[model samples]
Target: MKAAQTQLNRYGAGLAVDGAFGDGTDSKIRSFQSSHGLDADGIIGPDTWRALVTGSSGGGGGDSGLLTHAAAAGKFSAAGVTWASSGNCSNRNSTSCTSFDGLRQASADGAVTLRGASGCALTITGGTETGHASGTYSHWNGYKLDFAITSCLSNYVTGTFAYSGTRGDGAALYTAPSGNVYANEGNHWDVTFLN
Candidate 1:
């Protein structure tokens, strides 16, 4: 239990590390499990332990939001959605440059179960380096993602995919098809994850 506490703390569980698996620890475990696409049963099994130690099982990058390709690939699955990438981007291949929060929001939005589509599907057209302002920008820090309207599920309409947060704490911006938030880049929606 002490080892678990220490490991969970290292993984940003924010527990006291008191060496006991009490209610607080259990709640934190469940939250972590849900964020990582685990069963969320609050039981420290081999899979949960592995996630806590390695930070690679699903979306288990902890609070840092660092995501590996393997982790990002499985994040949507964890959220019970199907997604694909449209182009080769440096952030998609890097182990330490992806945004777990952005991926998480994407997965959450993807799991909405669109009415007319076969299922909820999303296509990632841009990431970190692929979409950003020409000059000073936040994408260089691996906090942005771009999605294409054509690649999104047929049922998803611009301005219908709802999310919260502003540019300061990360936001979803739409362009070309409808509303605008930050910049109008054309035919794409940009989502910036929390820093």
Candidate 2:
């Protein structure tokens, strides 16, 4: 808790490094989450911890927010979600594997949020895998995810979320209230969960 408090302080959260997850710390966490474009739940999950320590979302150069202790497969089962791959692959070093290594905690949380909000049976079609576009906020960097498109999920995203213009590739973009970007890629929704 003291480590968290110190990191939060680095981000200008003026809390005493008392090693206690008190109301003050919680409030500061929520505030930091809000400002950093994370879900402000005050729980200090992986995303929040990364943002606090890295001083940014999982963006820019370097390995600040890299998921050294990445969650393994079935990690999302607790959140009532599952994953499938086209090549019958798993989360590993293979190019076909739907690996979650280095995936930002915030992005994973955003997936959980989408599943709960739309009440749709979602399947994660992509993760920190190869064959995705490269960038500072690219999939390999763990700032994005791809979920298979379901009719229910598509309707909820298109009907409920606000239109935010289109991506350079012509995919339609929807902005969630949490500042995440959902790009309609026909077969899937390429989601970019912000810091």
Candidate 3:
């Protein structure tokens, strides 16, 4: 049961990972089964276990080269960024609303060919919450991230940054290869990877 919980959480169930197959875990299992075209019996039998472990469902592999939640939390430096708690904005509505993969991809884009001599870093300030009115739909699906440019090669602007044009201090919006949108939100950047 402990192993199952761990795997489910790792597979993006957003469960507590407490090693107990309580109601919450059972519900998540049923959802996973339904999505994967299984019997949806809320059972962790061989097939379900295999899917959870292998990420056979469409949700496991990142959109492109983005990192998984565990990978992002464990190896943020490799992605050329640092994680900071956004006060109440970190997990405003729920912790599960924040997409770790979205953060990883946004950070990767932010780090690309930095213009200034300083090492690039984006301090995450908001993710998946209602504290900010500007977020709206982007943050509602656990696919949006808000981060500020802590350090950069130059005074990063919306238009000059990679993957986007210009939107002044409002937002430099750019669509990624996977159709995810990244925007500049004044003091921070908002990434919406919901495709």
Report residue 133 deviation for candidate 1 (angstroms). 2.7
- The candidate scoring highest on TM-score is 2
lDDT of 2 by residue, 1-195 (tens): 999987765444557999988898888787666655578798888888887665555656575444432342323553466787777775545668787777776676577667667778888888888889999888888888888898998999999989999999999999988888899998899989894
Stronger candidate by lDDT (1 vs 3): 3
Tell me the tens digit of each residue's lDDT in model 1 across 145-173: 55555534323444454433444434443
141-184 in candidate 3: lDDT tens per residue? 44566666543512443334356565566566766555656676
| Winning candidate number (lDDT) | 2
For each candidate, what is the lDDT? 0.49, 0.75, 0.53
TM-score for each prediction? 0.40, 0.64, 0.40
1 against 2, candidate with superior TM-score: 2
Per-model RMSD to reference: 11.3, 9.2, 11.7
The CA root-mean-square deviation of candidate 3, after full C-alpha superposition on the true structure, stands at 11.7
Q: Alpha-carbon error at 161 in model 3, in Å?
A: 6.5
Where is model 2 poorest over a 10-residue stretch in terms of lDDT?
66-75
